[model samples]
Target: MAETVAARLLARLREWGVEQVFGYPGDGINGIVAAFEEADDEPRFIQSRHEEMAAFEAVGYAKFSGRPGVCVATSGPGAIHLLNGLYDAKLDHVPVVAIVGQTARAAMGGHYQQEVDLQALFKDVASEYLAEVNVPEQLPNAVDRAFRTALARRAPTALIIPADVQELDYSAPEHVFRQVPSGPPDAPSSVVVPAEDQLARAAAVVNAGSRVAILIGQGARGAADEVMQVAETTGAGVAKALLGKDVLSDDLPYVTGSIGLLGTRASYELMRDCDTLLIVGSSFPYTQFLPDFGQARAVQIDLDGRMAGMRYPTEVNLVGDAGATLRALIPLLRPVTDRSWRGRVEESVADWWSTVERQAMVDASPVNPMRIVHELSLRIPDDAIVTADSGSSTNWYARLLRMRGGMRGSLSGTLATMGAGVPYAIGAKFACPDRPVVALVGDGAMQMNGLAELMTVTRYQDRWTDRRLVVCVFHNNDLNQVTWELRALGGAPKFEESQTLPDIDYAAAARGFGVDGVNVSSPDELGDAWDHALTADGPVLLDVRCDPEVPPIPPHATFEQVKETTEALLKGDPNAWRILVQGVKAKAQEFVPGRR
Candidate 1:
């Protein structure tokens, strides 16, 4: 039998080092499915419960491996379902390639079943590259371009392969048959070196400032050592964006944990007072946390010049790789002898940790989510890959978890979507089979999509490279974040029944899916549950009964937010006053040093 275009395309993917493609099988993709069957196990196709999970899994794989993740789906809704996860990759700036099946070429113009313009559907999300393989000969180059564009741009790229084209026999061009090699060509090396003038100006700004601060993002992942060198040389304290959590160790004296809603007081103060802000590879959206233009002169380093001054007015914009730019500037930096600035911030971070520790130790009736995360932080392997859902669980993960070297994770960076935690953990396991993978998800988010992924986990639990996967469910019986947001933002009572959830026996559900499960009610139970999950040979789900009334208070609360809290208290939400009081206490710590 002659080779099909689908076979040729799959071969290209394998040649490009793709280990797996997360997707579902459908009539639209029968040819591609056949190709998978024929290839045996070259690039394993993971069957996902939902198309969104497939995309999210791909995102998780890419985040852990730093390689473009691949996902495939049938045309129309299957391809449409990928938008949320694709947007996760787009917003987070991770690389992903999506292969979408289409109707036959003849049927595309006709109103055939499941026929929609795949390119048009993906145009906005896959801005980097979107192509339709119309002719049989276009398969090879389109596949190559899709991967290359996805990698170089660090964005999602889509290739729409029509059913007719996929089924067509593959034929090499006469010239290509004679000249082309059997293996794929090596990817071109791309090193973006900043202009000397730009680097010099950036160095000058840092040297001139009496108080310098560095904001590192995901782009600076590979430049951690260089970032530290620069931070120490300039006596600058480093604050990390959420996605950049693993770039530096939280144990570093000058390092501040995640910045923004879940930010530390030390970090907020550092940004408030710093004279020079050195932003490396992060386009942090919350400009309120950054020093104002008049407050500090900004120097930013990013490969994309467009994002240079997008967040803040820049004195120097260096378009280069974060590690490369920092490496170049290190030699020119003059070390600051007076360490008072960073020393002060370091002290603040230490005190803040003390406050956090106290909060974590609170033995309440309903388990404190903080306590669960704290224990997990203490017990998790140094190299574990942790994924948190986009709600209260993220706040806990951000505030409590300390990322060490070799440990990495991700959330819905920009989209801030829920339901990615379980898929991300599963994908992370596939990417780094030896590393322990954990998903921290709230009951709300787990109900949204995580529960379905448990079925995905059970089916492929032992088949993955690493069999150690744990899902920690914060079974609070409420959409806790939304409940708090109503009080904190709108001065409203938990307005509707929509903000709450039915109590789910997640542990029982896990057992139903053929995985190990446990329910933890108290602090002691929580600790023991962690021990069990950490040591379990297969996938385990820890259904932690967390406090629904506890609020995810921000580091700094505004007067308007205070008013809302007061209103909620008046409306008889029992937790409102306690949350308000806690916010007051945290903010008060900013003024009086060494006072809890």
Candidate 2:
């Protein structure tokens, strides 16, 4: 049998050491599907419930595995469906390669079915690299470059393969003129370090500050030890961006939790008080949460020169790999003799955690949503991979949960997209099949797509060596995040038609999909439910009914924000009284005598 373009593409993927491709089936890629069958599922095709889920799963796999994830889809709508997840990857700086089938070459411009111009559709999302494989000869270079560009730029790339071209006999590019040939699939590795002068300047700035603050993002994952060494030398308080939450353990007394609107008071205070700032591998955009401009002498270390020095007015911008650059810069840094700043930061961190505990335990109607994650934080295994969807659940996940040991966590950090929690967990499971995975999701997002992804979990559970995937749904029956945003930001009451969600028994849905399902209405049941789900032989779903009135107030709520909330409540919020009560109770935790 003659090798086809589809077969050749799969072979290239195998050569690149790709273990899996997350995608859904469609007639546009009928040739590739047949080739997959013929290849005996080498570089296995992991089918997702939807194209968007496939892209998100790829993003998750890439995020956890430190490799470029690949997702495939059919023409037109399937390709379109991949945009949101691809955008998530692009915004979060995750490397992903999307291979989508396009309309048959002959039918492309005739206004035939699914004949959308994919190049235009994918232009912005895959701006790093986008190509159409018009012939078998274009296959190698196109696919290889897509992978290479994705990794090099740390962004999404795309390849559009025409349906008819996928069936053509494979042909390698000749070594003659006008033919573009590609070498074997191999990623060149190198250590990037900033120039000696730049490192010295960065060190000088760090050594000069009395109260130093260090901010880290996903880019600092590999340089944890180096970062800690720098922190100790400078007596700096460390603050993590949401994407970099797992970079440093929260147990570190000087490590302030996430820094932003959904941040810890310790982190907010850390930024507000620092005389100098060192941003490592994070382009955390909320400049308002950072030290006031011109108040602190700042230094930034980033691998991408393009992204460095854009977020803040840094005195020195060291363009290098975080681990290598920090290692080089360490020798030039002078140790701080006074430890008062470090002591203050540590004290604040401890007090913040105490306040978090008090808030999580605050009373609610049925259950406080914070307790769901707070309980999980207590029981989650040291090696668990936790994922959270975007919602009010994110607030608890950000503040309540502590990342320690080998635990890894991620979500749609930059894009802040819903419906990513379950798929990201599914991808994490595949990326590290031996590790336990947990997904914290909201009721709105669960209904949007999570309920369907459960089937995908039940289908693949046996493949995992440690099948302890738990999806905990915050069943608050409201678009809780947006509801709060409407009140706090827009100064508008929660419009029932827009904010309310239809109640669904998520646990029942899980059971129907052949997974264990537990329903918890009382706060007392959260702990036992988590224990059972965490130790289950297969995947489990905890449908936890929680209070929607519980507000996810910012750590440092401004007077204007409080005023807007009052205005919104006065303007006829449905649960105005309960909301006020919950907000007061939750916020009061910060001022409690010993807790503060």
Candidate 3:
């Protein structure tokens, strides 16, 4: 049989070493579906419950695998449904390639059924590279460019294929005028390093300061040792951006936990007291959390020159790979003789951890949300991959959970979207089937889209070598994050109509789909429940009834924020008394002599 464009596309993806393409079936992609049957699934088509979930799964796969994740969908609505997930990839700077079916060439402009302008829809999200393949000759170059552009730019790219073009017989571009030919699928590798003069200048700034603080993000993942060496040489306290939570192990004495709003007091203190700042591979946008402007001299090292000096007024912006750049700068640095700064940082970190443990142990009406993550921190496997959702639970995930050994963790960092935890875990499972994957999500997110993705989990559970995927749902019956935002940010009380969530038995829902389920309404059951789910033979969903009133207080809460919360409570918050009691107990831990 003559190779169709659809068959050629699949073959090219296989050649690029793509094991699977996360997507959904539709009539517009009939040719591609048929080719999958004929090709015997060389690159498996992992069908997701929704097109958005498919795109998120691709993003998650790319994030964990360090390769371009591929996702496909049908024309019009299916293509539109992929926007949010694609945006998540774009904002987070993940490499993903999306292939979408379009209307037949003849019916595109006629406004045929399920026909829409796909190129326009995808332009912003896949701004790095967007192509429409109208001819069979355009197939190879389009697919290849999509992958290359996505990898090079570290952003999402798109390929729009008309239905007719996909069904046409594949043909190679002739060696003639105006013909384009593509090279092999291999991407050229190189280590980028900044000029030696820039490295010397950066080192000079570090050498001049008596106290230094270092901040790292996902880009520093490969240079963990180099970052540690820099910290040791400069006597700097290392703080991680939320996305770089696993870049350095929290077990390090001078390693402060996450920075910014969902940050530790130690990190806040590190930033407040430091005179020199070194930021590597991170574009953390919250400038207020950084050392006050002009209070310190800062240097930023990033792969993209465009993002180098945007966050803070960095004195030297080094555009190079983090590992290479740090390696170059290390030789120029002078080891600090004054150990007082290092000692102070270590002391603060120790005090902060003790405060965190006490805060987690504070009493609540049902279960304290902080304790949920604290328990997981106690027993999480060294090699596990953890994913979190965007909600009040995120505060616990950012502060309480500790990363160590080969453990990796991530979420929708820039996008901050919910309903991604489950799909991200699913993607992580596919990326590293041997490693255990756990998703920390809120009950609101569970009801939003996670409940449906459980079927995706059950279907593919047998394919994973180690079938241990734990979805721990923080089953607090409220839109807890927004509730707090209303009180703290807007100075408004929680409106029940908008804040209340319909309570559902998430465990029963999981059980109906043939996955194990555990319900924990008491804090006492958390430890055992986590153990059971973590060691399960297949996917397990833990429905934990957490206390919604337990405040996700900022490490350094402002006076205005406290005043606003007080005002909101005085204006008749339904859980006002309980909220005050829990907040006091949680905050009081910091002031306790032994605990602090």
Off by over 4 Å in 3: none
Q: How big is the positional error of residue 267 in model 2, measured in Å on the Cα after superposition? A: 0.2
Go through the candidates in order and give each one's C-alpha lDDT.
Answer: 0.86, 0.94, 0.93
Q: After superposition, how far is residue 499 of candidate 3 from its true place, in Å?
A: 1.2
Clashes of each: 0, 0, 0
What RMSD does each model have against the real structure? Answer: 2.4, 0.8, 0.8
lDDT per residue, candidate 3, 1-596, as tens digits? 89999999999999999999999989888889889999998799999999999999998899999999999999988899999999999999999999999999998789699999887899799999999999998888988999999998899999999888889999998898877899889774888999989889998998999999999999999999999999999999999999999999999999999999899999999999999999999999999899999999999999988898898988999999999999999999999988999999999999999999999999886899999999999999999999999999999999999999999999999999999999999999999999899999999889899999999999998889999999999998999999999999989999999989998999999999888999999999999999998888889999999899999898899999999999999999998999999999899999997644
Model 2 bad stretches (over 4 Å): none
lDDT tens readout by residue for model 2, 1-596: 89999999999999988999999999899999999999999989999999999999999999999999999999989999999999999999999999999989988799999889998999999999999999889899998999888988999999999999999999999988877999878774888998898888888899889999999999999999999999999999999999999999988999999999988999999999999999999989999899999999999999899988899999999999999999999999999999999999999999998888889999997999988888999999999999999999999999999999999999899999999999999999999999999999999999999999999999999999999999999999999999999999888999999989997788998999988999999999999999999888889999999999999988789889889989999999999999999998998888888754
What does candidate 1 score in Cα RMSD to the true structure?
A: 2.4
> Which has the higher TM-score value, candidate number 1 or candidate number 3?
3
Q: What's the CA RMSD of model 2 in angstroms?
A: 0.8
